[model samples]
Target: MSLSPQFLDELRSRITLSGVIGRSVKLMKAGREFKACCPFHNEKSPSFYVNDDKGFYHCFGCSAHGDAIRFLTEAKGLPFMDAVKELAQAAGIEVPASDPRSAQRQEIQATLYDVTAGAARWFEEQLSGIEGAEARTYVKKRGLDDKLVRAFGIGFAPDSRGKLKMALATHGHDKLIETGLLIQVDDKEPYDRFRGRLIIPIRDQRGRVIAFGGRIIGDGEPKYLNSPETPLFDKGRTLFNIDRAAPASRKSGRAIVVEGYMDVIALAKAGIDEAVAPLGTALTEQQMEKLWRLVDAPILCFDGDKAGQKAAVRAGERALPVLTVGKTLRFAMLPPGKDPDDIVGEGGSAAIEPFLAAPSPLVRVLYNSRLSEIDRSNPEDRAGLRHRLDDLAKSCTDKILQEEYRRSFTSLFFEDFGWKGRDRTVVGDAISRTRRDIKTYQSIARSALYGCFRFPQTLLRSLEDICKIDFDDDVLKIWREKIVDSVSARPFLRDDGVIAILEADMISPPQKFDITRDLRFSLNVSPEVGTARLTRIIRFLVENEALSKALDELNHRVINDTGMGNYVALEKMRADVRAKIKVIRDQEYESGATDAEADKEELGGAAGQSAASATA
Candidate 1:
């Protein structure tokens, strides 16, 4: 049985190559592809790779390479027809019959492809000719040059009902209508579907012109028009500029989904080649899946308007059911009333790169979108918000990721609005007191000292701040003096030397506490983190200590002072100190040290020493 190229392409597109190989191979994600030990040869290290974007798997050790069908045939020892049938069933598509009817249908589809291609060429010709003068002016006005015009196969549809019909008349009216080049009524003659507009060809993955999108050159009812779904084109499954963007995305390690064809072209013009667009609709799961084939997370660039934000949330909700561990979406928002085209035109790629570089993750977007709609002052409204978040998180089909989303949502909620429903005044006062307490500063200072002990270079780098850090614990204060004196003497003491100093003084590193785990982990692995980051962590600790002292002093003054003016002044000072502490903590969190690996073993014999000293 012979299979048409189109049918096979669709089959491959529907089935992820990694999902197929993973059933037997246990594939691990390696950047944009999956890697496992070579199944063809006995290898300990993972050298076999499967790329879903290219729809092939290869082994570096055994020199094995093939597509999904070839994998079934060669690796699983299945016949060609059997493998094809299995893939077709998995893709939910029927294996085409070998009968003459099937052949005829395939032939007609091939003819339709030719008709679309011919129409595209004719549109290109008309754009370069006098008929497309207005479209040409519009292109030039948009800062599109001749190279972009030819690269995108941009064309013009003359504002006549019969021009496209007459130009591609050789392809027959039925074929033209089938490809969506012309529209036909019950009794009236078929007419051109796109006219008086700038034409941009939408190509398939293989770079064949499958459809056309036309933008109105002048004032019109619908500003843009797209081809009706035909035998060759499914608007939801097709993305504009995907043929070019796929390889570009693989090279750049990213894929960008803009709002329209022009935005894609604008990004390309600005040297950003890895960009695509949905065709006149909200982004679909099919389009998103196609993007994931090229990159792990594709950035969805939407306009910075309420409508665009709503669309982003809708896209996120649509994607939740299909999201797996590594596959997800990020959202980038252009300035209000300004798109990629406007940004690129005004300031080139530089202006747009920052937005694309720092997109909010899908979970954050969902949380923020839902949070913005709630009345946080009302307890019932807050409860409703929590339920909505839970529902959105549960929408994810991946159980592990669903739980992760739930945890992330819960953390974000608590961070936004702390614990509620209790003795409101007592809880609020306790939380406020905790924020100003010396124990908080002690934890921070001890974590920083432990970090210095484990990574002595951090001690030298942060010597200035270390000398001034007022440790609440007597042992920590003495250990700090010894460390500073030793590091100041040698100026480059290794971890062993710092350990020696601690051992001589009968001091042990601070025990890890729940509140200081992030800071402690950050300090423990200070070598991996550069000096600048370690210094910032130490500086924040010092600043936090100062604020804690200021708050304590203000507390004492407020308790003793009887005058209203004096109490108000003291309370204001306390508020200012608390605000500074919050700012310091926020800065530390944003420095990205909080997510460092927390399971690293203590340096040298520090763990044993910590245990022995705890008992002492």
Candidate 2:
């Protein structure tokens, strides 16, 4: 039975080669591909390589090569038919009964690839030909040598559209149009898509030219023109210089994502070859995922101006929710009004090494970007900063990570501005005095529970464990059960989502306490401080509950006259629980006093600074 070429192409594209190879081999991302020790042959250093976009795995050591199906047959020892069936299943493709049209379609697509390859060769010929004198001069002026130009497959698109159309006319106009070398419009003959521009062929992972990017030699409106989406090209999924950068990234252990093709070529000329650029678009999720596969965090190189800073922030925001623990982005900003190409032209690639060495982390860039946007003088402006930080924290879907970010931003806020407009002494004294009684700890735990509901983001990491804890207080237990049930039903509730759930159920706190008052107390405290305090209180409750259970078990043992060991152990456990309670309470008091003194000092310093400024 013959499979359709289109079906096989789709299957190859769908099955990420690294993932299939990774199952049996320990594949580590090297540049734009994954590398592992050859499963076919034993070796110390890894030589087996898998390029997912290219849909093939190769071993340099043994010269083994094939796609996913071949790997299954050769490595897994499956028969040819079985391997095809398995791969088809994994790729979500249904195998059809023998079809002859599949082979014809495959042949046509192969011819189109040939057509694009032929056009690329023609472009290169034009660059070195008499008509390319102007283009060659421009290339020399940019400092790219013959070897560098040839390495990047740099070519020249002639000014006349009909020139390329004439050269490849033998291949048929339909093939040229389909390959994006020629553009066809309604009621008009097809002309070249790229005219009078420096041609840079964009290749797939396998090093086959898939599309072309053209930069107009002189003043042009669009400046750069890329092939529109074709059967084999999607701008969002394509990155310039990726074919070379992927392998280079493995050696450098880094993939530097620059803003443009010029930056990529400039860096390469400067001996920094592990650089790629997005094709006339902001970095997309697919691009980031690809970059991550090559390196844990690809450094994003942006311009140093306001526009560049804004781009960095936007990229960070887009990456936040989907961010896993290890996967992230680093940012490199060139000097004011400068770019990678400009810097490399002036001082060489090593000049930009310093910026790359200390590229700001995603979190730092996110915070600093917001700070640059807002006014810091007025109280209202500062409040806006707080809200913005909170929103960014809430955007994180990972509960533990979200809580950590919330605390980090809160700490930064307090460190820079300190608490404002609220009486810290009064609030501290009230909490300190009220929390002295053991019963108050339970009340605080209950309030913390409500806080988790108020800000559902808080429940992300702790919800499940908190739900399982056995509570002696009837009212608090009821609240815990309600929260656990609600959260279990809708696990991803955020912001006012918890409140909406409660409102729908008409749930209210027990009449013994005012829910509003407790909520205000919890909400008023700085999130980091509140979290610490509540966490400690919860620990005390859990520890105390364990002690009580032990004492009860001892009593039953004594009633049955098991032994004096039960009574002695009970007394010792009781003392340990009391000591633990004392330690927690004392630590809380010390921390509270330290924070209060710090707040007062900050306020005094701010006042003094203001008075000095006024006098001056």
Candidate 3:
């Protein structure tokens, strides 16, 4: 079905590139752009970017790029027309009746992307001038080296009223504010929003600068001010360090998710480059999916304090359900009152290496932190802590892991309660209760209750991606194996099956507390989203039939002449484009539509004229 132009525009407007991208990838706000793992390819890190203002997407992993339609066409296998129609439907806009105007709007949007690019260049050049000396000194003082500053495209925004606004105007362009490069207080006058600060231009994976993050020099009230969610940037959906860390993560087979800029930089400096951080907020599940694509296991490292601990809990909860047998997670806590940066700063890479080396298991971290606060000195506290511990233990759907945890934890109680001297362990009774817990994979048995309504067949790939990998530690390995098996079994089961299987399962209080979170934030996904994704995959496979067939043939040929086969593949793709043009021409001919009738398409007057002459 064809979608109207208006509908397409609205759909484009309704879905921020950041949000759509953020759903699958974690993005940290870098200036106005969101950065995260390049979902287009496997990586151990993030280097993909989505620009809301510019309406562009790019990935550094395999150098893929284009607008949303292009992304759908490539990633989801939507024909350009189908993607537009779907987006239009989603946006609730009827496609524009006037195709010509719809076509014209495309050019206007294209011009906006160009204008943004031009403005970025101007900003970079200005930063090199004396006016930018202060910003330069500031970044340097903050411990960013010259190469790092340049790699981040560190520029300076002059403290002037509207130098940027005027510069754009002088260039015969006035769409600066539309790109969020500048802002206007009143309709009459506009000013650059990023002036007089150390500018960090945020780039998508293709490394095109889309937005800016500015850090003010010392004593400034707001030390760091990011660009307002402009047309091109959204803070909630961007991940910092995606540009540099994606490849590292891809290569290393893991991703390290940190808490802040300093933490990311400290890790990078210490040679642990597969780290990315959020844009000064709690790490969202939206961010975790991004990491999932790059590496099998994504390690969550937060500060050691209360807030950091809370963040870790949230991250753990979000990522656990997603964990599969091979895919795993570990948590790292910084020393009290210190961040990754603090450790690196105080003692260099050597000091912080141990923390990364000995990251904590998510289960242990979550349950342990909560357990410490309870006082066994009182009976109520003891009961409460037992309830908490019981709940937590129940969260593990793997009976073996649950059993192990119960046994291990029971031993701890014996030691803690000084029961090593006395006999008859009450906690030992809790261990027996735990034996029946997680006797079944609930999601697997209840296919109808696939959590989210949309689950995918290709999800098997994701299932394998997360579940099949083993970690160095035996405890973590065992824990992940159960998660993988439970989630993988979900696509085939009925809801009753799930209940029947899991009813036998019981969790200690601490495990229960974390288990719910694990379902929400961890590897567990909603069946609806998963199923929809699978539907899209089915559609894509059908749409790319010609290419798929050709690829099959080409793969056979590549075994004989690898280099020549690649050339042949390119040639075939080029031939396919030409074949499409020929088909379009024939269709227009059969329809008896003259060039004049379709002049509104704006595919260059030359094509129209040639077709007109041909018809004549």
Per-model C-alpha RMSD: 15.0, 24.1, 31.3
Give per-residue CA lDDT, model 1, range 1-616, as digits (tens): 7779999988889998988888767888899999998766667898999999999998888788999998765554344775787788678888887898976886677688789889889999999898878888899999899998899999999999998888788888988988888899997999999989999999986567999999998888799899999989999999899877865675467899888899999999999988999998999999887788777999999877778778888999999999988899999877788777888988999999999999999988999998899988888988999999999989988999899999888867765676322323543474477465435566666666766766777776568888888877788788888888898889778878988778777785544546535363344234645344455667877877776667666656544333356446655765666676665555344335343322122232344666898999
Best by lDDT: 1
**Each candidate: what lDDT?**
0.79, 0.74, 0.59
Question: Comparing candidate 1 with candidate 3, which one achieves the higher lDDT?
Answer: 1
What is the C-alpha lDDT profile of model 2 across 387-435, one tens digit per residue? 9999998888888778877887775676456542133354334334433
- Scored against the true structure, residue 230 in model 1 reaches a CA lDDT of 92
Could you tell me how far off, in angstroms, the CA of residue 514 lies in candidate 1 after the best superposition? 45
For model 2, which pairs clash? 31-246, 31-250, 32-246
Residue runs of model 1 more than 4 Å from their true location after superposition: 1-101, 419-616
| 117: Cα error in model 2, Å | 1.1
What would the per-residue lDDT of candidate 3 be over residues 250-282, giving only the tens digit for each residue? Answer: 556668888876677667766777888887667
**Which run of 10 residues does model 2 get worst, by summed lDDT?**
419-428
Query: Candidate 3's error at 50, in angstroms?
Result: 29
**Candidate that would win on TM-score:** 1
